[model samples]
Target chain A: MGNSVSEVQTADDVLLELRNLRTWYPTGGGVLGGGREWVKAVDDVSFTIKRGETLGLVGESGCGKTTLGRSILRLEQPQSGQVIFEGEDVLKMPAGRLKQVRRNMQAIFQDPHGSLDPRMKVRDLIAEGLVVQGEMRRDERDARVAELIDVVGLRREHLDRYSHEFSGGQRQRIGIARALALRPKFVLADEPVSALDLSVQSQVLNLLKDLQSEFGLTYLFIAHDLSVVEYISDRVGVMYLGRIVELASAEALYDDPRMPYTQALLSAIPGNERASGRARIILQGDVPSPINPPSGCPFRTRCWLAQDVCSELVPPLREVKPDHFAACHFADAI
Target chain B: MADGGATGGAMLLEVQDLHTHFHTRAGVVKAVDGISFDVPAGGSLGIVGESGSGKTVTSLSIMRLIEPPGFVASGRILFRGRDMVGLSEREIRGIRGNQICLVFQDPMTALNPVYTVGTQVAEALLAHQDLDRKAVRERVVELFRLVGIPAPERRFDEYPHKLSGGMRQRVTIAMALANEPQLLILDEPTTALDVTIQAQILDLVRELRHRVNTAVLLITHDIGVVTELCEQVVVMYGGRIMERGSVAQVTADPKHPYTQGLLASMPTRAVRGQRLAAIGGAVPNPLRMPAGCPFRPRCGQAMNVCVTDPGLRNPGDGRSVACWLY
Candidate 1:
């Protein structure tokens, strides 16, 4: 796995490919219906996920990582660019074809309490997708739901209970089972374990890892916690204000971060054994508003190594080393 | 100051066998059951637990903020040779926000939405001290500066909606520090902010310790936060203190099985691509706690002796554990 970075993966190995995708929302038009200002939630982001691999997306709040995930799923319509899934462009597909294509892709949300319905029983919640697809019969759906619950470490007796009856960890398990009810090949998990307890978080993470292997799943795992991202991700991408600032193998990114933003983020994580002996790089100020980002680099205002060029010109995500990309003007120098 | 047990320094706040319970329709909820610890003068102590582990309730018990249906059943909360278990409402009010201040987790809810940030902080000062209007404004600005809010003069007039999350948290901290309380209680202060913002807040706390001689009682679920800011720690489970020791001793070599499980389950401590040593079961329900040891239901090292409560036993090295294995 360490040497696979340099090897050219075959075209068929690519499960999902995002190309210059942009998702923006109009801001402050005030009922006139013509707003010049736009909140650039996801701006010209491009990435690819290989088959049976996990790609982690990490950023602070309002960095557009969640928007990027929603855009790929077409839950939020993108203004431009492509989301190629299984050699087909998802953005250009017709509604009928897109509906058919979506059966292979699914999502797991962050909040267990908010994501699951209070009125619905565990059985109905897990079988909601199967019922909507209208292909599987009642008995078959029941069998599939039972199997999924067992796979996710739940008992059959739990089917009659409502979501409120279950604990947070158990509710999250039900959420995972529902996501896997259709047996998706690609899953996008957005902060799945952030709301869970420390012990239960590990349980859910281990469950996700086991399920990924048991069913050859490719995942685009998005989270704000850097340690959790580093633990579960094969490759990692760091986002700052709707742009990918750094992308590399998880090991390489943690070991040798070229971008100052990534360096500060890694150092910001407390109780990191590797960082305990070194001086922490504490970035100043809060994240800038996404509605009107800084002119050149989004992170230049808070960057310790920012120079005149950093504020004068936009930096592109370029290869800093073999298979390591960073969007900093001084990436090579770093 | 007792001058006994783990805390040897000049004691600031010492909690002895605290039992805070809530009377519900179904049954009594033991939110904090028999927990004990101390905070030294100018020292920091972190109380860590999951959602139902009673960490928040303990802080509320200390502040005497437990409302109806919830009450501090039995405990000796000693603050500087004064027992605070049965104080009158008016008497406790004097000490609540004046001598000991609290910083909540969500800054948005902590600050009033209608009031300007400056007015809200000024209200905190006006409630306790008898300062003049201009003097109150000056003190508010100084408090904001102390908490690291940028351009305090300009930000003073802005409402809570205008400031960012980090800045809002700074406002809450400034409000907490307005009277220069002898003891500060921070309940998950950085949990709502982003990582960079959390780092900034922790640094502010560290810097404030040097200027003001205030002891800190930090309540959080994150072990990392505890390790970074605290000298001593108390690990809670089912409202019980499972272990109590210095952060160095506990994180480096945890004594209790529950503590070991928690430390091992942390992602920062785990190696990549391997299965995490996850503690299997969920936290026990507050109302339907286990018969003997609160954690025995999920503990891997539970013995027959665990059927009876081991209570808190002192092992060597100035640490305490409540497990049969000890």
Candidate 2:
């Protein structure tokens, strides 16, 4: 299990590989149609998720974490990038092939109440994907839906219930069952437990973990909660205003964070036992608008050890330690 | 204030048998049903619970702000030994901002958009105090500074839309502190802010509370926040107090089953990659809560006696629990 976080077998075994991914939303501040500025939501982001591993993505609001998840699934079109899955560049896939790609890659959204359709029954909701993508008979589809409900810790009788009739935790389970209906090799769960209550959050989280192991799934788990991310993730990548600032194993990121942004984020989590004794590195001001980020390092404006050079040059994500990478010019010196 | 419980201190606010109900068309939703607790002077009391747990309603009832479908049906809200349950609207107006202040969740909705942040804070002072316009302006700047808002002079003129989420919350706090109230009620104030911003706001609140010696009534669903900002805590579930004790005792050794579940469910506290011990079942429907214990459906340690409501009883070590086990 420890080896899973530090190293995967090989690049050939990589389930998903993103290369120089750039997803930007054009703002209409300048010209009506032409000279639009980019929000730079996911600016030059890249990462890899191997089979049977969860890579946690974390950042503050508007840091482009959610945008990156949406971009990977192609829910939001990227201006340029390569999302290579199973040796296939999904971004370059034609419409016919892209539809096929969708079957292998699925998403579990944040909102349980809003994500599940109210008009649809629980059975239809779970079997919707299979009905469209599979050649299975009606009874086979029904059997699969029942199997999914049982796998997600719900009873078979629950298939007849409406989504609104279920609790938050149950609704989330239904969402998960729906995502797994197509038997995706990779699952992108975007804040799956954020909207749930504290106790219910743990239930959904545990269910997701159980299903991940049962199905041999790969996940790009995205959230703002550092603690939950650390708990569920093998490796983590910290985002800041549309760029990955730190990438490392969960242990390394928590035990020793090199980037100032990562340090601030770790220190910010309340009730970490060490929180009372430690001095928190509070970042001043709010996250800057993505339309026009700072001159150089996005975090330089809030970095405690920010030097003049920090604002002059963008720091690249470089390996500073064994199996740990941080995007800071002075990462080693720190 | 009944000084019978743990960590003996001057009693600042005491809520006794408070039942705040909502007379909706569906039925009488007992949002807060016969709940009681005590807050020490200059100390913080945390009302920890999930949604529909009556935590928010408790605070609103204290502020005499429950409107329309919701009303405080019966309760004794003793603030400095004064019964505020039946206070007239005119009387509450004088005491609302002057004696006790409230800063609820969603700073955007709390603050007026058209008006500048300065005007909103000044309005609090103008309503309760007899300070002139110039003094009000000076104090507004000071209040902003007290809440750690940068460049108070410049921020004073800025509209609520211009300031960020954390900044708007600071302004909201400044307004709440306009008259230096004896008791400050915060209802999930930091839930909407980012985690870093949340830490900053909580720090500012702790520092301000100590400086002004204002007792705090903090309401939140996150046990982490409660542990950070509170001394005493009351765990609520389905409009009832499931457990009440000092934060130290409860977090260190939670007696109630519900409290134990909440503590174990915290992702930070739980071990990495391990399944959290989540409490099963949702809160009972507010309109049609169970005739028995409200938490029985979700309680892992439910005994046969849970079929009936358990009264609050002392289980030793200066803690009170409402359960059959106690």
Candidate 3:
């Protein structure tokens, strides 16, 4: 009954595939006013999430990692893209059918404080999705809510209390419970543990892993912390200026990065004394504005390997290794 | 018993038996309860702890920045052997930003959005230094260049929103450096910046440490950053010092159970997929703190005698630990 989004067949094992997704927000003015500029939040980013796979999107803030996750979930409408979910086009689904699409996909926002409604009880907060979808009767929803609360490591008493009563980690558990209440096959977690303490962060991460195995869930995990992403994600994608600069297995990307940007990012992780001997390539300056990005390659401004050709040609995502892809002009050379 | 001051020379900042409390309607909350540490001159000290560990409040106490309901009840905050808690408002104001500057995490909040970056830097210099308007402009431009901000002249007039996160951080650093403070109290200075940008800022701080010879009090929640910047380390929990030692001694061989739990929680360079050893429970509520050890509920090594809280006594290798095991 929960598997309603698989409307068509692409004859592939991947659960979600996004092709050239672009989500831009217009800035400045409108019709009878000055020319408007578009902040290319998610510019032509393309990737796939296999069934039961966790694809970690890593980048600094303003790099559009969150926008990419939101766009894939259709939370933010993309200007143009192919959001093929379970062989069905998520972007092209009708309003009535779109509800079905949403039933199979869920989102866990970053801020636990702002995400949950303070007025609602934990019971209704978790059961809100099930109630909206009308997937079960009132009694069944309540029982399931109790079960979900227990599954998320919270007590039955917490169900009657408001979100403000719980701790940050407990509130995040409530958020997780709410996201998983509908039994969505895929979940988009955007910086879920960033707000948590180090000790609490590991608990949430462990719970997410346990839930993934128990429920057979696939996740599009978005986070800025490389260490946390490495701990959770099977495969990782490095995004910059609204584009995927590098994509590879977590271990491969950390151990053997090819793209200059990727290498710079990996080197920047504050490792221990053994790793301190290696020289860190601190980028010269901050990321350029996405509204009016640097010409040719968006990352060319900060790239150490930048040559004249980097300014004249856009780098395409090319497979440098067997399974690793890097969007750089000198991918083969590196 | 003889905790009157820094005692020995070469220590730049000494916080002795500090007790900061909040007289709220509910009750008195001992935010910084008898914590003591020292930062050597031209050396950096990092205070690492989770939220409400009194790390922030301890730093605030040092700055004499505590306000009405919250006050430093009793403490000796010696800056270059001068008493901070005893200083008058006007006297302390002269010390602040002139000999002791603060660098915070969120740069956007530090820099006034209404004014240009140039104006902010110029204002700090105008307050502290004896520079004329023309000299202040030249010095602001110089400070920006010193902070490695690209095209200092062009970026001088840019508002906080106009610059990216990293550039905004650099501008705040420029303002902090305008007065050449002997000790820089950086409260999670790079926590809000991107990791790459954080690397840049740390490298900049390392270089400036030699150039300006300024001692740094780097307070953060991240151990990796503590290892990267500070030589001395203090671990705080429930507004008390759990462990204090050289970073090499404490981080490499953490003595306190809480310190051990905190270190084990972090995902290291180990291969992916390994489960992290998470601490069992959350930090206890300050209002309803457990009778003995603040971390007893969450501690894996809790014993029967843990009900009696222990004092921070030195174990070997110039390190102090507050645990029964030690």
- Which one wins on TM-score? 1
Q: Which stretches of candidate 2 lie over 4 Å from their true place?
A: A1-10, A30-35, A273-277, B1-9
TM-scores for all candidates: the values are: 0.96, 0.95, 0.96
Please give, for residues B1-326, the per-residue lDDT of candidate 1 as tens digits. Answer: 11122245678899999999999999999898888898877778899998889999999999998998999999899988688987888988889888899999999878889999999999999999999999999999989889988899888899999999899999998998888888899999999989988988988887787678678899999989987788889999999999999988999999999999998998853478899999989888777898889989898888888889899888888999998776
* Candidate 1 displacement at residue B28 in angstroms: 1.0
Worst 10 residues of 2 chain B by lDDT: B1-10
lDDT of 1 by residue, A89-149 (tens): 7887778777777888999999989989999999999999999888998999999999999
Tell me, what's the RMSD of every candidate? 4.0, 4.1, 3.2
| Candidate lDDT (C-alpha), each | 0.89, 0.88, 0.88
TM-score of chain B of 1: 0.96
Leading candidate by DockQ: 1
Indicate the DockQ of the complex predicted as candidate 1: 0.78
User: Which candidate comes out best when scored by lDDT?
Assistant: 1
Question: What is the i-RMS of every prediction?
Answer: 1.2, 1.5, 1.4
| Per-residue alpha-carbon lDDT of candidate 2 for residues B156-240, written as tens digits (9 for 90 to 100) | 8999999888999999999999998888999999998888899899889988876887888899998778777888889999999
Question: What does DockQ come to for candidate 3?
Answer: 0.70
